[model samples]
Target chain A: MERIPILRMGDVLLVSIQVDMHDRLAQTLQEELAERVVKDRARGVLIDISVLEIVDSFIGRLLGRIASISRILDAETVIVGMQPAVSITLVELGISLDGVRTALNVERGMELLASSISLRTQE
Target chain B: MGLESNSKLVEVLGEKGRVSLNDWKEAQWAAIKIRREPITEEELYREASDFMSLFQQAVKEAFLSDIRDPVWLKMREMLSALSISRARRGFTPTEMATFVLSFKQPLFEALKQAHGTDSGALLSDVWMTTVLLDKLGLYCVEEYQKTREAIISRQQKDLLELSTPVVQLWPGVLTLPLIGTLDSERTQLVMERLLQKIVDTGSQIAIIDITGVPTVDTLVAQHLMKTIAAAHLMGAECFLSGISPQIAQTVVHLGVKFGDIVTKATLADAFGLALKRIGLVVIKKSGE
Candidate 1:
């Protein structure tokens, strides 16, 4: 029953995966992320996975699914801090992770989320 | 089982080592008759002389069954060095192996003169020499192949790095001019380099100019799409340029949908558009 910690930064929910995630732990994170997106009334979600080096297709799909679910709850997800090798591996794996936003780091992720939220509000 | 044959080999070599060495040099000189530029006859004689002395010492102490033994280590080392040198000098594998195999004829001639009285001992010694020389000759071929493959793979890696270069045409604009076919492996390199460059420069626009890419088949298109998609996820806007009329027709006929990926016929046109996106305009000087 291990849970990945989700921190609340104002209107954004921050999830940082610091360990080598097993399949069950990743599944739990997906479900918990969706629930927290609803409970915290978050406008944006930023996931920091710079620590994740080995990203298989399953984990890639889970990220895409999280983005889809967050959009359903009116929240945007920005996956951040992907290592260079991981990006190459994911592209080779043919998992494009469509509809999931990304940034180089968490700071840029926050900027992107802020701009996206402002754009939505203005629209 | 090979101990008796080993001692007989040592005895034959010890008695006629000098005469055999001279005959071995003559055989080598004749074997390399086709080549004139890289290695001179004098250098060949020197190499053969050194190798003969080493071979005599090895016959005294080395095991014929296993070339990896410590006593045979120097002989193996010498052969590998010779093979690599010849490979670099553009000698074919057949020629390199001939250089090693030629030693067998002279050694066999000298062995017959020494063990002529005893047919059984002579046969055993001749058979042992054949096995030993065969191993050494095959080692030369293996080393030559390994050197050639190592050289080819290194050059290929260099070509891959040189072909895919991402240059910054403007402050916020980058251009990756691809000049060759886009396979999956090169596409992966392009993606990694483009993404890293995007992050480094904080550039928002990337122009992929594939003017030199000769074809736009489905696989190439798929690779391009993957690169573009990865760049998009990195928060950069990617566009395609250098699309000739032929490539355009092929892409259209193939029914490939490049949704919203601004395409241009030339890099100049793409640069103009990129500048416009970044709010920059080019103006000529007054009297140029």
Candidate 2:
């Protein structure tokens, strides 16, 4: 039962997926991320998937689901560091991952989350 | 008749070698002169002499009916090399075939001299000679065609590479100036190169300039959208630039949707937007 670790930086939760995600692992991650977001009172979720080589429609849907769940929890989700091949595959698979903000890398993702959070707080 | 004709052919080739080789060279010179092929006399002499020796050796050893026999491998290899070079030198298929077929006249003359007053033997020998030389001539033509095809495909690949060039417009912006029509294959290449460049340069904004593209139909629009979608997935915003009036009218008439992707009339406009997205602006110097 391997679990992907979710770390908290300030009010943001960072999940760097370094392993090939399976259905079970994705499901576990979804449950864990939801629980942690509520427990930590996080305002943003940044996911780094630079090491992920393959992604299918299921994983694409999972990303969309995670974004939706975070949005409902009053947090922003920014998926970052997606490989070129994976991005092309996702596009070809017709999964645009709508409603999920994305960035080139973790630093950009953090900036995106910070601005978005600041913008929301001001509103 | 098979083995006997082959032996007689070999014998004539060996006995009157000098006379027949000279006759063969004369016939080749006449053909080259008629075609105005830019082949030097010395080069022609050397190639014909080399071919004669190889042909004599192969005929002495191999089955006359089959040029593809392992014993005739040397002859085939020599002709392949000859045809490929001639093909590169702009020799037509007929000219290449004639280069081999011209040997027939000289060899037939030698056969007539050897089998004088023997019609039956002369007939079979001539038949064997025609079959062998025709097979070899055809082999040369085939090799010529193959060389031409190889050259054509190489140029095609070069054209594909040349047409799609992704350039960095700024530190965080890139532009792909696409030339030629967008087909599925070219689109795939453009997408791959643009995406790889995006990853390599870490550019957040990509502007695809389609000014050089001649037409915009539904299929082209679909391909452009796919590329934009792929870029979007990589977290880089793509701006479509260089939409002429005709292309815009055609796109609207065809009902092709670009969705939320930004479309600009010119690359300069797109560059301006891109620079703005990256928080940069060009201010003209008032003093100058």
Candidate 3:
């Protein structure tokens, strides 16, 4: 069974989806992400998908679902590395990813996650 | 109208082509009834003369049935060039087609005078000429339409680029003043341009000015939100300016929520907000 590796750094879980994900892989990643959020007590989840040039509605929904699951588990999720074409495609598909936080790249994603998590802690 | 080996239409036209060409030129020059004449009479005469000579040479080398033969290449080139110019000069498709069809009259008269008193032979010859000339006329119209489409598409691209101008007001601040309808195509263009500019300049703030936009419906609002969302993903804050009182009422009545987006009534207000966000302030001098 192929599984997406979830790397933990301090209080954050970093997942970079570098492979072309199928339905099964996306499902597995969603389950693993939810479980890791609770087990590791992660404060934030940063997902880098800049290499993902194509984003269908299914993958778009999966991102939104993961954001929701993380929010429920008391962790903030920030999606990063979205290509310009992918952004246009997602918008065209009417997938707003309303609850999902997005950053330009991993570096900016880290900054967004750190700032957002700090804001949450203060609240 | 079977002619001897040497009496092919091509040879006949070649031998007496100058006479046929004069009649064709007169007929063509007189048929310029278009309100907006694209070419002068002299220019038209020159083109007509050139085409007749080319046609005579083409037919001399190949049968009329083989319209795509290499011999007719020059004729086709002339027609294509004429079609494009006519399209540019605002000539309608019918008028452009007429330019080619008018040649048929002189060719028929020349053929009749050459093959006098042979009714059966004249009918067949005229029929062949009709088919050939009709094909050429249709080709001219087709080329004219193609050229018009190309011109229209180029102008549309120019308009899109003109409407979306991304100006860097400050080091980390960019402004896009939109002055037209926000359709899906233009929205996509705006998003790509704004995102690329953000990456190029590393600008963290973008102000989209819509004061010039006539109206904002639900769909337009959605496009605006999508653009702002994409910019947000890029770690840049997007501010929308130029919300008039009527537009504000329309937005609220339409139940469109901007959700944490900073909206201002004018570009100046948005600029001020952008400046404040970037921690830049301009104070009045002691004695301005």
Candidate 4:
């Protein structure tokens, strides 16, 4: 699957997939998306996979792997607006996201990144 | 076969009227089969068909009556009540599978009379058989999980007859082969397990094999040491086996000595050492 459109508001990059994704593409996603997100050393990342109705084992595992790579590049990853079905399915499947952070929607994602960016500016 | 049993059947149906599939099967298989001689296929088919028509007529009359003089409006209420009954007795998959096994005349007779599992024959029956089967499957999975959890918990409990921990390479004696990372909780568990096994087994020796364990840091080594000590307290000797060259070097580098502990290079060697120590040194059979 192709990378979704990139939207930038100030230093924070809103990088969300327009299409629902599967598990097999996680590594390739990290390799490809990492380059775009890292360009000019962007401030923070906002991932919106909320439009996705279902999340199986493979997709859950991929999301975790993606979040870990995002951490290594010195950018905080905030997963925005996971559907209730996705949340329930993830729980039933016992998918663990120990290191990943989350938000309700893009607005909240922006709010979270704003704080992170301001904290960096203070330093 | 000679005399018609309708008069007797009418007499029974007059008092009770309705009979379940199980009761009907008992009446047929048990009451009739033993006393009378075995009948041919022609006799079986004739009797089966006779019962099917009789059953179908009775069901139609009852359903029509139920539809008219009924306070329970929805069919779902009746189905729900049946569901509750199925729950109380704990329905097995084999029983559920039997409900779908045949659509032949005798089975059709039993189903029509019973008003259960007949739903499978109709695409628009009172209740879909597939739905019932799905519910039964989920129940089976739940039952299996509960059984698995119960077995694990009972093993962990302090009961000699109940508990059975995995003891690798054994009939009477057992070897608890330790491998991988050991946290604080795992250390405690190892000690508890070794002590429990020693108390339960009444064996003279135990071998804590560490072959699959890649590296032994201080925490894991300490856990092993604790396990050995716990076993010793119960008057059983503990043998440490499968010390790799890399692990040996790490131990030397860490300056952690064995402190006069029983050590062996391989599992085979450990067995040999155990046998020799127990005075099985000389071969009584062909090979030494």
Candidate 5:
């Protein structure tokens, strides 16, 4: 739950989550996430929401809005390291995180991030 | 504005000295004013004032509420709706007007046919057929208006039914961000439409951002799987966004799992991921 806003390694921006995601937090995430991702100037985004145990309506819509902005910026965002318990709770609660992308462990997420950085370099 | 007096109805009736001048004159004038090519609100208001001058304030209020002048839009809307239905029924306007013109034979036959049954009681209450039919037609028009409104609302609801009443929003992307309970029907619908959208748009990616989703059951997980699978077949990739902790708990508790699908914490991250997969960058080179 360390509220690390930005974790930059070369070109990729890894955003670390530190609290349960309610609406206001979700809005902040979009703004902060957008700011960081834009700074990469369209490289990639890696968001780590492992510490967030719950997400409510505000956070969910804000996430969608943020994704829309990312598309406009021509960048990529990869969510990594979702807790199994959190995933199940969100599903039961009728949450739609899975509709965003495939859930990867932190290790896999970092690997994907590293690979994307390399891929961008190659491009 | 001047005729908005209570004594206007008595005065006009007194001037004309006619008991049956209800459909007299200016009602038609006001209706015509409403239908002009470039409708003038000022003219309409003037016609309405004249029309109201022929009625008592109470009657004027009732008539205004009933007829809703300037009636151009309302009348046009009702007639157009009737025309659509009439097309289905193979009924033509020419036939109706012709029947009205030669109303004698039909009326006599209708009365004779109805005389033996409940027509006795109905006849006791009835007076003039012309007035009765006009009132009945008014009722029919009102009913049609209600139905049309309902259908339009249903269409909108059908489009963005699940998450939060999704509107077409933009030209390309049709988005529904779900927040509360994913029952079986909603899941099925979301899956079905998302698949159809892939076919419709030829979009390579469909993002399902679910940061607000509180829980996921086995069926909901299955619903997601089917949708993603369909999207892939249609040459589109689906993005699962907003993986909250509560959802994780439900997925695990239900013991349902998906294999090797793309996911992100936020939609922005998901979009970023999609971009990266396609090898697209947002960087610039030279100084401006």
Candidate 6:
């Protein structure tokens, strides 16, 4: 089983999914990300899925689950670089991913996470 | 009928081809004149001559009862071209069918002259002529109908493209002004175009101004929400603008909840909010 590499940028965990994710891979990523966020004391998780061309209902739900798990772990998850077609498909599939924060690209996702973390600290 | 009458019909068409073509052209000219059609005499002559030669060749080679046979391929192609051209030139189906049916009278005259003594052969030849010409006339009408349908479908596609235009208001702001009813098909097109534009321009804000949209029912409201959700999924904020009081009432009555999505009474307010979200402000310059 090939493992997806999760890079850490400062307090943010960057996960760029360049390959198609199957059930096992997504499940592993979810479990590993939860463990990594706790161990590394990461404040945010940025997921880049621009190269992901196809997303079924399973992947959509997995994204929502990942976001919820990160939130519970005291880390914000911002999904970034979602393609237009993927977003349209997700909407058509009626998977709104209600609680997840999204951004246009990695840079915006970082800015979002940084501001959100700063806001929480200010509060 | 027997093959003799078929050959006899061909023989009369071959021998008196000039006179029959002349009569056919005269009849077409009279009809065009009466209808004040803009067809030139030379164009009519050319079309009649081309059709006459193709018809003669096809009748000689193929069975008279069936024009769809491969033997009449050239004839069908010629008629399809003629029918489509006439259809584009604003010719009615009756006028197009008449262009083929007018040949019947002249050919009947020639058949009378050739088989006058034998009423049996003349009657069979006339019947074959009528059947073949009627089939040809109907083929023209069918082709005309197909052309009309092609034109209508093409216009429908063109209208779809023309209606949905994604315009960029500022560097990171885009606006989509919908001008008609929001059916599923139109909504799908608008959503696709708006999403693609958001990706292409990397616009952070999108304003959908429905000022030109006359009404909004539950279905339309659902479509709007879906579009906004899709835009949000792509990381762009969406604003619904230009809601009239009546539409607001209808939306409230329909129990359609916009939830946390922003709604505005006009595009200007939406634009102002969009600018503020992107950290921009429009202020008038001080004049001397």
Residue B92 error for model 3, in Å? 4.8
lDDT (10s digit) by residue, model 4, range B202-251: 45567878886788887677667656644542335679999899988898
Candidate 1's DockQ is 0.34
For model 6, chain A alone compared with the true chain A gives a TM-score of 0.97
What are the candidates' individual DockQ scores? 0.34, 0.75, 0.38, 0.01, 0.02, 0.79
* All candidates: TM-score: 0.76, 0.95, 0.78, 0.32, 0.32, 0.94
Model 3 pairs in collision = A50-A81
Model 1 residue B192 distance off true place after TM-score fit, in angstroms: 0.6
User: What TM-score results for chain B in every one of the models?
Assistant: 0.91, 0.93, 0.87, 0.41, 0.41, 0.92
Candidate 5 docks at the CAPRI level of incorrect
Q: Model 4 TM-score?
A: 0.32
Off by over 4 Å in 3: A1-42, A54-62, A92-94, A105-123, B1-20, B23-46, B58-74, B89-95, B111-128, B249-260
Instruction: Give per-residue CA lDDT, model 6, range B77-132, as digits (tens).
Output: 98999999999989999999998999888888888887768888888878887898
> What would the per-residue lDDT of candidate 3 be over residues A30-66, giving only the tens digit for each residue?
9999999999999999998878877888998999999
User: Which candidate wins on DockQ?
Assistant: 6
The collision pairs in model 4 are none
lDDT of 5 by residue, B187-236 (tens): 66676666555435434566777766677778777877766654542334
On lDDT, who's better, 4 or 6? Answer: 6
Error of 1 at B254 (Å): 3.5
What C-alpha lDDT values do all the predictions have?
0.84, 0.90, 0.84, 0.56, 0.52, 0.90
Task: Supply candidate 5's per-residue lDDT for B27.
Answer: 40
True contacts kept of each: 0.33, 0.62, 0.38, 0.00, 0.00, 0.69
Interface RMSD of each: 2.2, 1.0, 1.9, 22.3, 10.5, 0.8
Task: For residues B1-288, write the lDDT of model 3, one tens digit per residue.
Answer: 223342336545776452566666666666664353656878878988787778777666665555666767888899999999989998889888888888777777776776778767777777777778888898899899999999999999999989899999999999999998999899888889998888788788999999988899999999999898778765678999998899999999999999999999999999999999888999988876
Clashing pairs in 6: none
Q: How many backbone clashes does every candidate have? A: 0, 0, 1, 0, 59, 0
C-alpha positional error of residue B191 in candidate 6 after TM-score superposition, expressed in Å:
1.7
